[model samples]
Target: MSIQDTVDEMAPLRPENRHGTDPLMVLNGIRQEFPSSRGRTVHALDGVTLTVERGETLGIVGESGCGKSTLARAALLLRRPTSGEVFFDGKDALSMRGGALRSHRKRAQMVFQDPNDSLDPRYRVQRSVAEPLRAAGVSRADAAERAMAALAQVGVPEDAAWRHPHEFSGGQRQRIAIARAIATEPELVVLDEPTSALDVSIQAQILNLLLELQERQQLTYMFISHNLAVIRHLSHRVAVMYLGRIVEVGPAADVLANPLHPYTTALISAVPEPEATKRERIVLTGDLPSPASRPTGCAFASRCWLATEQCRTEAPPLTTTAMSEPGSGHLVACHRPAEAQEALASGLQLTA
Candidate 1:
């Protein structure tokens, strides 16, 4: 049977579904904290609120250790947030217990950066692919049949299904990992830099597969990556994170093409696009603020050339800038949104 035959149709949209809410997932006031050596708490995620509409890819971009993976796990309730709420399909996921939580988890899956971490070295590719479906209570025989179909969907040959992960190439291993994720028929797949470890040519193949699978399965994705070019290619919307806070977010075209925040510009300017030589002007200096001492005002203030007294003394709420399109929801947390683009062109130089 084709992979299509193994998977059932999706359920009808839930009624009262946040009642007119288009968001399939809603995260509000999400905060995650971990204790450090000196009994100081590291705020990995601080007050992040965002929505992922059904069947859209929301690309999350940021530097390493900016809580991209933490946010991905938190959204799935893998690590309960220190303070906040997560709603999946209008149902509060935080309070779920036993079967309900398992059901929620089944609908949301994650694709990690390394297939070596996600796939067991000892398990046969077929067995690994069938594991989640079996856990979801599928009969062993049926799970085996579906697993083969899933593997085929991702271009794994039927005869190779019995081989261990060690037998596959890096790209093939990732394809199997993707097969395992989609095998359960999840609604949302949180991909944490899934292609970062692959060769550039392999990256394109994996990206193309993800796009095809999303179109076929109507999957919602929270794709986390440091590659802005990849984000621009796969995302309908983009959220730029810094020091555990979203500095800017909006429609992908608007945020990438006309970013209002200095931090967002810095990320875009480093994309290594063909035009990067001429356009790569916004070089941000300084590492992200130390975890033990986060900034009281704007997280980017220490490095921002535009940092004014207001920016240094007070945190700017992420609100719509003057240039933001109405109903488009483009927002930035900058005290001087209007001057960012022009300033960059007119000798606003920042040291790397």
Candidate 2:
């Protein structure tokens, strides 16, 4: 099926239907904490809740330390969360052990940021691609056959399969990594900054390859990246994170075009525009708060241009606003969402 076909098939599942229908993945109130050297706990993730429907792409965007990667790892159960529930295809993923966990691992896969780091230089490309199949108990001969087929599918030459990862360029190695990811025919793929390391031209090629693979396999993607443009290009929905919390989430177009949270607005504004168009930029001040010493109220209040007394004292819950369409699920956590929305609508330049 084509991407559009998969989208159309799953179109009936609106954000409102997320809880009602069976989703590919569900993370409810996930929180990850680590003990800092200073004897305090760092909140890597704070109350992150999200759902990924089958055959849809959910793009996660945030600054470097905003817990996007932590959320991804928690979803995949790589790093168990300090608290929360993880449901994969309606099953309790966190509670599974041994055989059940192994079975679940086959259904979900991850493609890391750097292909060079992910692929073993000591092994042949084919061996690396077939590792998952071999781990699943497939015979060596069958795994080799599947590996070559997968390599060919990703535009890697069949003859090059026996070569080491160092033999190929960065983009080619990424193709090999992608081939390995889909070789198992996983239903969900968590891509953690998969294309960020490549040049712009190669990034486009990899993105196209990913979209094509998703279409052919009907795969669901949890794509994590700092690039808003890329997230807008490939995501059906977008989640914006700040300081271990999701500040805003909604349909990709709606969230990017009409951001409702101060953080989201600032993030979107930072996206490079055409040279001819003059757009107001929201330049935020103050460094990101240390996770171990996070503010008691809104994590972003210290740097938010629209912050009020309420923002400084009271934590805002992720609330669905009237600005959101009934099924669009546009939610924002802010004490002054209206002011933020108004600032964007009025094209006011904000420096805080």
Candidate 3:
């Protein structure tokens, strides 16, 4: 069957399918832009809308400068989008002020990409970890006690709590950072490339630690990374971004195993595969278009081998697609999704 025929056979994803119980975070029509000195606006994020279900990890993956970090910041309310509604646990977070906003911010925490950059070298580990607690009005003694326990939970030695961030190695520092992030017992955590700065072995350790913490604390995560393997391992759902928009989103395993979007297929094809089961790679052409001067049509049309005249003239909406697994939600934005799906099914090599 043709891809469009296949898509037609599937039911559209319902709103309930995209959410569970009460989602921990929701971004509705988020659009972030910055005015350049040249008087043109740089579109950092364009109409990003997604939800992070409580206790599930939603991974955002894309090339650098694809607005992954911008989305993260906007979700955390660190950088309020130029236009959008942010909701936390059904509350309109974008409308909160003063103490209400501070309280909401405490419920969500962030673990940055670099521990060295995130940690204060001069502060002792306990103080660093206790900062959030202190900010939340916890007494110094209680905060210290919680800090020690948090440090211990992440496998940092209790004795090390008295030492500065400079005393620990990169991995240990990240552990400290993780300890600090969770010290306040946040319901949601936004991890921005948390493992990218570490070595391979250390990356595994950190990932495992995060998994452990999630199980123990029922933490919801917005895990952002460019590493497909990492996303596959850690995410319940994955969102694929390009330029300033999410092009594909679905259950992580489904999207990784049967990518329906050309951009997604090209990305997955680049991952290292076992020689015995390797398929031809999809090599894309052309540099990424500047966000300051986005194309009138699909942002990825310039590099898509399957792109047609329609792709060059009109942007595709994020449309729902049939998933192999029942009750799974898969959405892709492409003018030629059917062609891209056929190419993958036929194991046809795509190059541009």
Candidate 4:
């Protein structure tokens, strides 16, 4: 059967839908490597394993070149992984054949970082939004109707839909991009810094729009962003990535309030605070190591002040930490998390 047919058949199944039973989307030991000169490989994603539950928003946060975007592309099977599996709705996503894969593409959609780049200048907002519906085999009449509705849903006016992308503002173009992404009512949406290109005020509007849409349509999101503040607002759980591996994964509240991992603490510290007295800035030292020549142990080890001899010699696997709970589990790939927390409490200046 076609993936769309399969999705239609299984989408009605509520009994099979439970976060604990299995993830709606799963990444198992996935890796993406690019060939470099002199027999070296660029490890964009090094064995990343993640899970997104049904109707849940999972935030992925990391520095640039930390492989979070690559992971998102891998999840959508847009960037083929060098190793491992991508499971979508309990099916082997990577192994999907021909039309099944095409159908899967319809079910999974992406909202890119830049609005200007995503939308075609020549195409009107209505045409851009209707593009997906047309590919989905909807009639031109039905697609046009749906496209206008989508534009309205994303806070664009019915009149704006008739205009070209170049005629609209950045925020408006982004809204149009969002409308196109949700035009087909995708089950999974990968938002890669969807609001980063907009103004601070406009970012909130877009975030609110996304939340409203998710609630209205019961959509699942793999929100990829570097902004912790944005992630905290939109995500139920947050996964912190470094180099190519997940350093920390847990409930947003726990991870933000009491970050166990040193890297997580450093990331959270960088978030700007309104109050001066309460804010403690963590200025990390040096530059992030290149993915092609990652450290032998933890990828964060070179920058991590808490790194011990063991940390340099042995790679820390993401094991179930003590913070794992019923609904939300906190996992940290660090052996010295407790020590790092203690150092933070002692007012130690954390250098990268």
Candidate 4 deviation (Cα RMSD): 7.9
Model 4: per-residue Cα lDDT over 127-243, one tens digit each: 999998898788999999999888888888789988999988888899899999998889999999999999999998899999999999999999999999899888877899999
Q: Which number leads on TM-score?
A: 2
lDDT measured at residue 261 in model 1 versus the true structure, 0 to 100: 90
Question: Which lDDT values do the candidates have, in the order given?
Answer: 0.84, 0.86, 0.86, 0.83
- The sequence of per-residue lDDT tens digits that candidate 2 reaches over residues 1-352 is 2223433443433454333245789899999999999689999999999988788888999998999999999999999999999999989999999989887887899999999999999999999999998887779999999999889889998889999999999999999999998888799999999999999999999999999998888889999999998997788788999999999987776677777898988887777765637766888887789888899889999999888888888999997887765667778998777788777666657766
Clash count for each candidate, listed in order shown: 1, 0, 0, 2
Model 3, residue 340: distance off in Å is 1.6
Candidate ordering by lDDT (highest first): 2, 3, 1, 4
Selected candidate, larger TM-score, 2 vs 4: 2
The lowest-lDDT stretch of 10 consecutive residues in candidate 4 is: 10-19
lDDT of 2: 0.86
**Candidate 2 vs. true structure, TM-score:** 0.93
Give the poorly placed runs of model 4, Cα more than 4 Å off.
1-22, 323-327, 344-352
User: What residue runs in model 2 are displaced by over 4 Å at the alpha carbon?
Assistant: 1-22, 274-278
Better of 3 and 4 by lDDT: 3
Q: Which prediction has more favorable TM-score, 1 or 2?
A: 2
Clashing residue pairs, candidate 1? 16-19
**Candidate 4 CA-lDDT value:** 0.83
